[model samples]
Target: MKSVQVFAPATVANVVCGYDILGFAVDAPGDEVTMRLTSTPGIRISKITGDDGRLPLDPAKNTVSASVQHYLNALGQPSLGIDIELHKKMPIGSGLGSSSASTVAGLFAINTLLDNPLTTMDLVPFAMKGEELACGHGHADNVAPALLGGFVLIRSYEPLDIIKLPFPEDMCVAIVYPEVDVPTRDARQIIRSKVQLKDAVTQWGNVAGLVSGLFMKDYALIGRSMVDVLVEPARSILIPDFYQLRELALAQGGIGFGISGSGPSVFALTKDPETAKRITNTLQQHLQKIGIRSLSFVSSVNQQGPVVIG
Candidate 1:
């Protein structure tokens, strides 16, 4: 294939209890990248839209292009030329895994053009380069789900082990992205490196309960298990009216609500689409009442991670 276009869905990382470990893909607000092979023997970004030129065009600096470069190097073809064009459909730095989406799309496109030279799991290290370059540390909560789809658990990172979890077909999530930016680097700095033993125990219980709830298909257990005893208390203060918004969502029949990745973007899970829509509407209106204009959407869990568009 001379050219390939691929799409990678947005992901909600952390999932309240599983800090830096769990995440899931959502249907809307993803990134699309079109890659074309060239004979020039170098990587070049020909166009980028919806990011306001904030993203770098240089392959060494840009997340998507950097991932493409890594993939080429992995295939023992560092000089292979490719032209990449990015279409960012989601807001940057909104805690929605925007960078991961772009990274996954680029690697997926390149892998498709190469006719599956690498397995999906084999592309992870290359895709993670994008996250490492963006945030100064490599964490796969966002990248794993964006590449593998569905709910994922990073069981062990020492060897980069990941497992896909169960998500019921009737489940839906409401995501609200306020017109605000929370860089992951800044968000990570606010979190304390250590937690009280009590808090740590609470987090452990919640994480275990969450995993069990999903396997059991018990939505109530899942909802109750979405409590974050460590990071949320610190990171949530950065988001405006975060507590009020969660209360409103819960009141509106949302099973659970919390910050999406770090802050500024929040999500609620519901057993049905109607409840998801209601929570999204209520949250958006609440943000508006507080003079913070927001964008909200309800999406079923994305079963397919990244795929070629044409």
Candidate 2:
């Protein structure tokens, strides 16, 4: 039997401007899952730790179980047996790629145990299957970064191609998850049915600039490009004091602040750890003042993806 432990870093999706199309990883806050191939020819999954009674363990509902099953099917190993265990170190529905981490860990474990049957590029679509089970939509932006790390720019879903940018060393990302629930499906619905032509043109132009900013390592342009003129307007209604809080974070020496993935959660990018810490305090204090409880995490930009830990 082959056993392996995997860690999939938490990812920030839809970082303000790019909804369902952009995501980046963070190192300190993440989830872990362990997998081992069994002598038998069946599949089983168990949630042993974290998420105090929040997540379902059944193979049909669990993210890890589904990804491994998909991998097995593609490799003509349907009869292959595996036992999976999930450690929900990251909270469920926290918008930190909770489900994506599960899927990535499970898929990576199986591929390694089976002697590296698939490449990371080939495994992306399979990882996306896990997201589909949760949101009824599969956007590779989050999964790709959770598995591959760094910043990802997803150009098209049909062709499934993304460019991995070289991240800056001085970058720091502080993620704030208000202890509130915003269903991914509900958040998606809140976006406008259509966008104005001017907004559409500006949105694409910003996307282009955001993509280019990373290559040039221009933090200000990166922050400026983080503007959202389409989905954010409608979605902001779902989050209490969303606009007011975002403005406060930006004003307090933070590079930028915006919605963190169809969220009640918010995040900001800073040039250094000190700025990140300052932003976290200001954002949390503002949320408390508004009667919204929140948990803040300050993490550096994850430049590397998931890797086996012996």
Candidate 3:
């Protein structure tokens, strides 16, 4: 194939309990990237859209292009030429894994055009370079699910261990992106370097319970275990009316509600699509009442990750 276009779904990282170890893909509000092979011997960014001119044009600086470069270098094919075009459909620094979607889309597209030179698992580390550039942390909580789809658990980081867990097919995710900018790096900085052993134990148990609940399709257990006593306590203060929103979601039949990744974008899970829509409306309307303009979507989990379009 001379060219390929891929759509990578937006992802929710942490999910209240898992932090940097878990995430899942959503259907709408993703990134689109197109890659075309060229005879010249280097990657280039020919066009970009929807980034408000804030993103870089140079291949070396852009997340999608930088990931493409890393993928090529890892395959010992840096001399090959490729042109990239990025369309950022989601807001940046909204805790929605915007950069990860773009990075995964570019890497997935290029790999497809190259006739599947790398396996899906092999793409994580290469795509992480983009995360490192964008957020200064080579974390896979966002990118892994965006690349592999469904619910992803990062079992280990030393050897890049990941597990794709089964998700309830009918469950829906409700997300509201308030018009606020909270960079992942800044949100991460507010976290303390140390935690009490008691809190650590509680967090571990909650994470374990969350995993089991997800696998067993136990919605009640999942909701109970979605508590984030560690990170949320510190980060929730950064988001306006965070606790009130969580309370509203839970009252409106949401299974659980919490900050999506870092902050400024919150998500809630519901057992069915109707409940998800109601929660979305409730959240968006509440935000509007508070004079905060927002964007909201209700979608089932996206199991297909990234797909080739053209």
- lDDT of all predictions: 0.91, 0.83, 0.91
User: TM-scores of all models?
Assistant: 0.98, 0.96, 0.98
Model 3: per-residue lDDT, tens digit, 202-241?
9989999999999999999999999988999988888878
Off by over 4 Å in 2: none
Better of 1 and 2 by TM-score: 1
Which is the better candidate, 2 or 3, if ranked by TM-score? 3
How displaced is residue 20 in candidate 3, in Å? 0.9
Instruction: Estimate, for each residue in 100-125, the C-alpha lDDT of model 1 and write its tens digit.
Output: 99999999998888888998888888
CA error at residue 306 for candidate 3, angstroms: 0.5
10 residues in a row with least lDDT, candidate 1: 121-130
Residue-level lDDT for 216 in candidate 1: 92
